[model samples]
Target chain A: MEFTVQDKGHYTEVAANGRLNMVAAPKLRKVVDEVVNGGGKRIVVNLADTSFMDSSGLGALIGCLKLARQSGGDLRIAAVQPQVTMVLELTSMNRVLTPHATAGEAFGND
Target chain B: MTDILARRTLEEPAAEQAIEDLHVLLEQLWLDAAFVPAPDQMAFTTAVIEAASNVVQHGVPTEGATLLLGVELTVAVERLRAVISEIGAAPLDPVPDLAGPSDLPGPDDDALLEDYDESGRGLSMIRALVTTVTVEREGDTNVWVLSRDSGQG
Candidate 1:
């Protein structure tokens, strides 16, 4: 899996490209941690290319969310694929890390 | 006997790499059996990955034995199935609870989300995706048989 963090002025967009499974879960946390620690508070995880995400991946996202919140910011997700969406809903995490329609829109209203 | 339409089998040391490799095998099996719908393919793939990940993450190897991840994926006209085994592993001390929902906070229950169970979500997900799932101990292996009905109207 590949991860790219781009500063979009309003919020940092962290794009995850590939399966976000057990193997790639920790990598995601590391990327998001870097964003949060590097003065990028408002973050949007772009999952447009992430085809799959198991529980491990979900946990990583939740962990990132907490880290962001504790720092007086928030983490959001956008462009979730079908499989990833199913996981979010099935695990009932959709409410916590809501999926925005697009990365550009994640922080648009804030 | 049921004639298998398409099948893929993989066996390796139950490690992180094995999960990645088995995902590739799943894609290959779907390519060979294109008759399965996209939704079925996605759901089945997720379930299989979760089960296999469970073995790698939680399965304990017996004394002086190496845990191996063994997977057998089979696709037929009306079904998609996989037998994921934890080879040379110790028996599950407290077998997984596949009957009811495990301890996952509701989507809107943000307060309880802080206490979410790490391992429970995967098993719950497998239960939600497959038509039927069963796990048992045979000799030294813990086998997970997962089947999903495909192309059902």
Candidate 2:
């Protein structure tokens, strides 16, 4: 998966385009780590183009969430695809990494 | 014997690239077996990928042997099945627990994430997605068979 990290003013948007499987898991960690180290908190991973994700990808998301929280900020996911949504729901991780309809709405209520 | 509506197979070095290749093969299978329901396609595809990924990530090579990922996917009139082989690998030190859904972690996401094992999650997802899943040592390979009942109109 190719990740594009953009500074969206209030939050940094990391858009992943491609399958988010084991092949892309470590890359995600690197991108999120850079964002957190770059002083960009309030992160949002835009999964609009991510067609598939397995356990490895989910684990990466969880780790990134923890990193963001540890840095005194937060990370959220938005625009989840059908398959990705299914994995999240099956593993019950959706409760922690709730999906938003759009990136803008991820932190809208916060 | 049931008539196979579609079939795809692959053998590659057990690595990250094999997972991506398997995804492509799955897409081709779905196209050929377009009659299969979307839910079944989704669930079976997820199970196959999870099983293949486990081999790529966890299968240990035997002495002087290189590990390879082998996948055989088939779609019949009323079922979807995959035989994933961890070729040239040693037997699992501790055989995996192929228990049921009760093995899944509870709804506490915080605690779940704190001590989550992706390998374990992958196994659980495979079990939950397919109607049946089993692993056994076949010669130098650890064979995983996953079957999901489908095509019931």
Candidate 3:
């Protein structure tokens, strides 16, 4: 997976593209660590361009959420496609983590 | 490749050959379930590959210990069901209480990500795809039941 991190002042937007599978999960975890270590709490993961997410990918996201929350911040998702949305829904992630229609909405700007 | 199929098993080293054999099996099933969409097909294949690879790597230390993979493809008007079973290691828990992705952390977080070099996201992908997944352990065998909706295909 290719991830581009944008520093959005109060929150950081991590945009992920390509497949987030076992192979790419480590990079994701590293990125999350960078965000947390950098003291950026409020996070928005934009998955609009992400084509695939496996259990490993989901686990990484959850881990990041936990870390971010423990640090007094939260992780939100936006622009989830149908396939990835199906995974999130089947796993009941939509209930625990809020998914917005756009990055701006997740950031509470829209 | 005949249309009417019966069950079979293959045992090989953890080399590329084994993955190739698995691909062949998946290809046959994918062709049989033509109505299933591309994403579903890929998900199912990935799950099978992950499970099978796990058996080769963790379940059996030596190549002598055979990894049993059974495939059954049933087609109806509304759905296609593919059940893959393997005689291998018993997982900590096959059907984990996953309320949401946020409820649990990745194996890597808890330091459970074994073999960091290769992939350990089989169960994760399995949970991602498929309408329903049922995992059962009987004696020494682990069975994974996967079903995909043909209508959605």
Candidate 4:
């Protein structure tokens, strides 16, 4: 998986592409921690380019959400594809993380 | 020829795509077997995928290790049986005990999620989806055997 991070002062956005399975889960966790540790707690993860995801990937996202929340901010997701969304919904994470249609919407800037 | 598909000594990194390929292969086998509603086939597929993922993540060497995955199919009058085997190092103890929905991390807890982060929940998911999950040891190699019956449906 390839991840690119964008920091815009108040919030951070992580754009991820490729499969988010066991091999990539740890890397994603590290990214989430980096964002929180850098004091960029409000996070928007853009999954527009992610093609596949599994339960481990979901777990990582949930962990990130927990971290962001603990730090007095929130983590939101945007532009998730159908397949990834299916896993999230089946696992009932959609209700917890609350995906938005766009990054700007998740950031409440639009 | 009776339907049979075999992939032997499958390396760890190749397991994920191999699982996808096995799905297709099992579908073709179903067609040849002339049976519908083969729950065992689906269970076998899920179990093998989970086993392969486990081997990839835990059993093989982090740098370079080889694991063997073999699948064989047999069709009888009222049953379709698949045998899946993997040879590798024994997985870590306390194999994931998957928590039910009620046991999930609460909306407020972050520590529990982090504590179990590296464990093998995939294997637990597989066990939940299948009828039987077993492990055996032969010399230094560990073998996982998984089976499911059509009656499970």
What is the C-alpha DockQ of each candidate? 0.69, 0.76, 0.09, 0.17
Off by over 4 Å in 4: A8-10, B1-9, B12-50, B60-84, B91-120, B127-153
Candidate 1 per-residue lDDT over residues B1-153, each given as its tens digit: 667999999999999999999989998998899888888998999999999999999989999999999999999888899999999999998987777754554544666468766687788788988999999999999999999999661
Off by over 4 Å in 1: B101-107
TM-score of 1: 0.95
- For each prediction in turn, the share of the native Cα contacts (below 8 Å between chains A and B) that it retains comes to 0.70, 0.70, 0.11, 0.08
Tens-place lDDT per residue, model 4, A11-43, is: 789998876766677899999899889888789
Model 1 steric clash total: 0
B1-153, model 2: which lDDT tens digit per residue? 898878999999999889999999999989899999988998998989889888888889999999999999998988898999999999998998886453565547678778777888898899899988889998999999999999572
lDDT-best of 2 and 4: 2
Count of residue pairs whose backbone atoms collide, per candidate:
0, 0, 2, 0
Ten residues in sequence with the least summed lDDT for candidate 1 chain A = A89-98
lDDT of 2 by residue, A20-82 (tens): 899999999999999999998899999999999999999999999999999999999999999
Top DockQ model: 2
lDDT of 1 at A7: 91
Off by over 4 Å in 3: B1-34, B37-153
Model 2 segments more than 4 A misplaced: B151-153
Docking class of 1: medium
